[model samples]
Target: MKFKISTGACFIFFSGLYSNLLLPAMELQAQNINIPIVSQHNALVLQVDGNKNLSTIYFGKKLLDQAEYNNIPELYKQGTDYTGILNAAYTPSGSRNLLEPAITVTHADGNNSLDLRYVSHTITQVNDDVSLFSVVLKDPVYNFLVTLYYKSYFREDVLEQWSVIENKEKGAVILQKFASANLYLKAGSYWLNQYHGDWAKEMQPEESRLTHGIKTLDSKLGTRTNLFQPSVFMISLDKPASEDEGTVLYGALEYSGNFRTDLELDYQNNLKIISGINNYSSAYTLKPNEVFTTPAFLYTLSFTGKGNASRKLHQWARNYQLLAGKGNRLTLLNNWESTYFDFNENKLAALLKDTKKLGVDMFLLDDGWFANKYPRNDDHAGLGDWQENKQKLPNGIASLVKEANNNGVKFGIWLEPEMVNPKSELYEKHPDWVIKQPGREEYYFRNQLVLDVSNPQVQEFIYGTIDGLLTKNPDLAYIKWDCNAVIYNAYSAHLKNQSHFYIEYMRGLYKVLESIRAKYPKVPMMLCSGGGGRVDYAALQYFTEFWPSDNTDPLERIFIQWEYSYFYPAITSSNHVTDWGKQSLKFRTDVAMMGKLGFDIVVSRLSDHDLQFCKEAIKTYNAIKPKIWQGDQYRLSDPRAGSIASVLYVNEDQSSAVIFNYLVNNRYNEGSKMPVLLKGLDPVKKYTIKEVNLYPGTVSTIDALKVYSGDFLMKAGFNPDVNAERPSVVLEVNEVH
Candidate 1:
């Protein structure tokens, strides 16, 4: 149940649900919080004014209550006066492990109460003047997430302080308090920032231009309103300003983490806040009130070594070694379009022959080998039934696997393990197997039921089913795991009021990956949640690569691929081809190189010239695959700003490197010679650069591209008039050794 309480200067909120799975009920207890004067740096002092007796905080039946106030500066740190706070209560309950603490915090005026029921052992520490915070969920897995919130007041005329705290590695630290505002990238290292008003997805303020030195990008004063209601500014670090040495570390203080080459903008009507967890941080803004009422929260976080994150990433990389790793990187060909339901072994083998000629290494059967009924047996009928169709391939999977192996390719199969069809045998046997409300009609999408991953039996069935296939065929090279449709009407048979659709679903997925890795430590697995539908770090840490998008249009990929590169490692992206409508083949190949280059293309139907081009593109990708896959990427232009240029560079040896630049759209006037300034170069080295020109009647590597010291000028322009409006350039260089 949710509740609202108002006091002399605070608004207390009661959220009954706990945030994550890490604490139990037995150890948690009800407690009260007193607004104390927290002084920092000896130069600045902060005090939560106007509140005294706050002893009304309690839970159902109130089993345990502790009100001892002890300032443990060592555990919580007291040297710094300006810092953020993130605290949680842990209680051991029954046999369920640990549960989160639930209690109400009554305000001094007795007009408001803030009930905190769910918490994870996470905190955000903001010190000094820089509005910033960090997330502290210890390695080896911690059992809580800490969140802090307070009502901000402001005059209706001013744009005040309102932002979210962040950490360096985790990307973002936000309290997505409302359901209407959705995160654009969905998940990654995220931080929060509040503009003049609600976030304007596409607003580019003229005052906030890229700077070369340390300078405040934005400083505005506005009244904070929780849904347009008058309140003061609330500014905290999503990512601290100190996080960047210069204004243009890469480009701007982008919300995009290490790999961000693009910026995504959104405009919301509500007072929405987000976070970018970084180092020791804090939020300090004025609260204007001649009279007020309500209570707030202090969120703090602690930092671990950077390896805490890289270690997780490394583990994931090893687990999905088939799409990565040396020698073991399985080159795969998926027949999603070719055999949506029609291809048998002969048809598959025919494609495999062509795939082999083009250096393809794995033959994958997509979406149609199990159901004998045509269009009728699509995602709806054949799902959950792993049996191979007799008429489609009379020899069965073993024979097909053997045939593919003989043709110099490994075999893989795709499955949506999280769903089942009503027509399937599994569903018929246990109608209660799927998640459903006791009486509400369960809606179906793609003619399938959302398998109850929350149920251990369901999880076991999935794990055993896939494990059985792999055990039967030790030669299986890969598995394409997919989850279709968005989650709605969430219900878990094993949980009550436990609408942990996101958390539980992720847990089940991790369990599956863990089991897979434990059993087959070397098999490569690719994650394809309806083509980047479920793209997030939680999943990336388990699978090697994620299918970027089903849309292969190079034009569309420019933005999608650009954004994906912002925070994630390049090797995590999986590019594929489908029968996309009217897109230039050159552009498609160009975009595919941004990720793990492969052909989802149909060579059998393409012209000889197109087919040859594809072969050469593959070879080109192979030649510089190391750089594109491992090199650092920079976003030369912001798509949000109406420019059409995105560039990625590869520098493996530090001696030689290559770049891929795309002119997304010719928005600049005919005479505008857009500047192409290269980044991530050794400013100390006097290197030589050559431009690979593609135009007119011939190709030439003009080695005359001049070099300029990065100390003074950091930009150069390319003459579009010389190469015509439709031009692309590849810069190759060798460092002066």
Candidate 2:
């Protein structure tokens, strides 16, 4: 049942279902409470609990925060209560239960749950940092934590990010902010990590807030996902550092999540986990009719140095809330190489054998697996044909799906339904179905033509093709939907005019996606352009992940990805470890872990020593992936400023943090010092720091690690003979809180 906690000045409301119930007291002193409310109405708090707290659900009505769109007020609440209820029956306009706006609460001691739905909960924000609401339920469940944060209306311009201090010994503040506009600044070692794939920051020449860009053979245009505001939300886990030191900051904007059908846009479910210096925040989800109960420890900071500590913390968290917040974890390894050329079953099976052993969870088939004569090796050959290449695989698509499943790995496929090739049977049979200028020469990229999804016939065909594939093979787990070419000679036969085709085409694509998702809700999909070509926020509503770039070089990625992280979630970006590099295995492996760690290089190519190292790297990554993807990201150094150092660390559950430090330059000089102080960790916990790959034998005791209010000395200096280009060190510390 829904529960509301009010203390005259502070109000808390929760909704969701769970089996356990514990009416805990508001145990905090009055001075420690502050609620960040997004609106005056619909500000109720809700929570959901399940067995062992597998997921904690938090939900509430959020008002959209928009400064650019003129129709903000109109769009704010227009659909907040819209239950997709239409003319189902005749009823008075003022009084109708068609919507059934109610909060549901489910509880189970361990396995059995009682669900309670409450339709009446009036919510109001009493002040800027406090809100009050009330809910009535027949029974209540306890032992669940409740919290109230912003769940604002969707905005296209901005993104939110939450960063914690990486120091294992010292308590540091955590920073969160909603970024505004795309402009970036040379802040301290703070950098934002984002999951945006191959899209540029600059607007396309003809691209507007709505349209303009070339369409790919898959009819996937780069112009659709552009952000309304290039701004980012930021939070500081410690005292702010000087903007000058080229301290790169990492942040990301990911577009993949669980979406509900009733809401045209994905149901907004973005939040940040803020933890105090001594405690770590638990991962939770919000359920209906339950209260969002969160302990204060989830959002605390440690101060190593006393320099405007609380101010920094508030600034950080508030900034993240201001920007639209979303996140993702796990970088993926795709099989574009294995399937791109229409390899046979044996070829794929062989390729997957090595990939699975390399610690990769996902194996994505990139094109070429579908169709017979119209092999998808190139864009112009296979557009509308989503059939399997039987000649290459006598066992059919199910065999490959089953084979991958048996190997303990998830299998994914690629498809580009938005376009067609003139030579293909689909386009030849329906010449009027393509989107192009009537008289002008049809644009062809890799011999492909963009499909006019605006046509109901085309949408139906696309849907049927996908439906058939899923029905035929239930083992399909992932898809790498790629858009290879750009829209040239753009026009839609179904549109009233060419001027409206761009937006209309996008809308049609969304419609097709909506239909597809209605049937297949569990499959994960990734958006890929030529490479970071169509990166933006719009596509995020539909897709779960994105490819950062086609370039797999480690050193190059340090910069390429460093730039992209400013407004995306680090988890959505796939980092592939490839042998395409001439650098040392250490450098490459280290760089790969910076993003969602994956392998693209031939694993067999590495030496015995390298192989062992690779295996160890995988183990290390798995142990720390949660922290890297979820903890606050900070850029300790930048190559642009001639400082070849970059560091990212995740708190070690209030005990310590694992740090990946890329020393671009040699720092092997005897007694060379790189005195670094960490933040966002527990000072109360005992910690031991060691450079796992650097000083393998040395360990330092951390006694309440202090935040660096000023410059700190390095532990080591540059090596006398620097390689000029290689990642040097990786640090892993253990906290004993």
lDDT of 2 at 209: 15
lDDT of 1 by residue, 387-484 (tens): 77878778878887887788888888888887777777767776676766668887776677777775778888889978988888888778888766
Candidate 2 TM-score, true structure as reference? 0.58
> What are the root-mean-square deviations of the candidates from the true structure over C-alphas?
15.2, 17.2
Candidate 1: where are CA atoms >4 Å away?
1-331, 372-376, 494-503, 639-643, 666-672, 686-698, 701-729
RMSD of 1: 15.2
Model 2: C-alpha RMSD to truth?
17.2
- TM-score (all chains, Cα) for each model: 0.60, 0.58
After best superposition, candidate 2 residue 613: deviation in angstroms? 2.4
Candidate 2 local lDDT, 85-167, one digit each (tens): 12111111122223211111122322222222221223443324433333322212332222222222222111121111111
Lowest summed lDDT window (length 10), candidate 2: 256-265
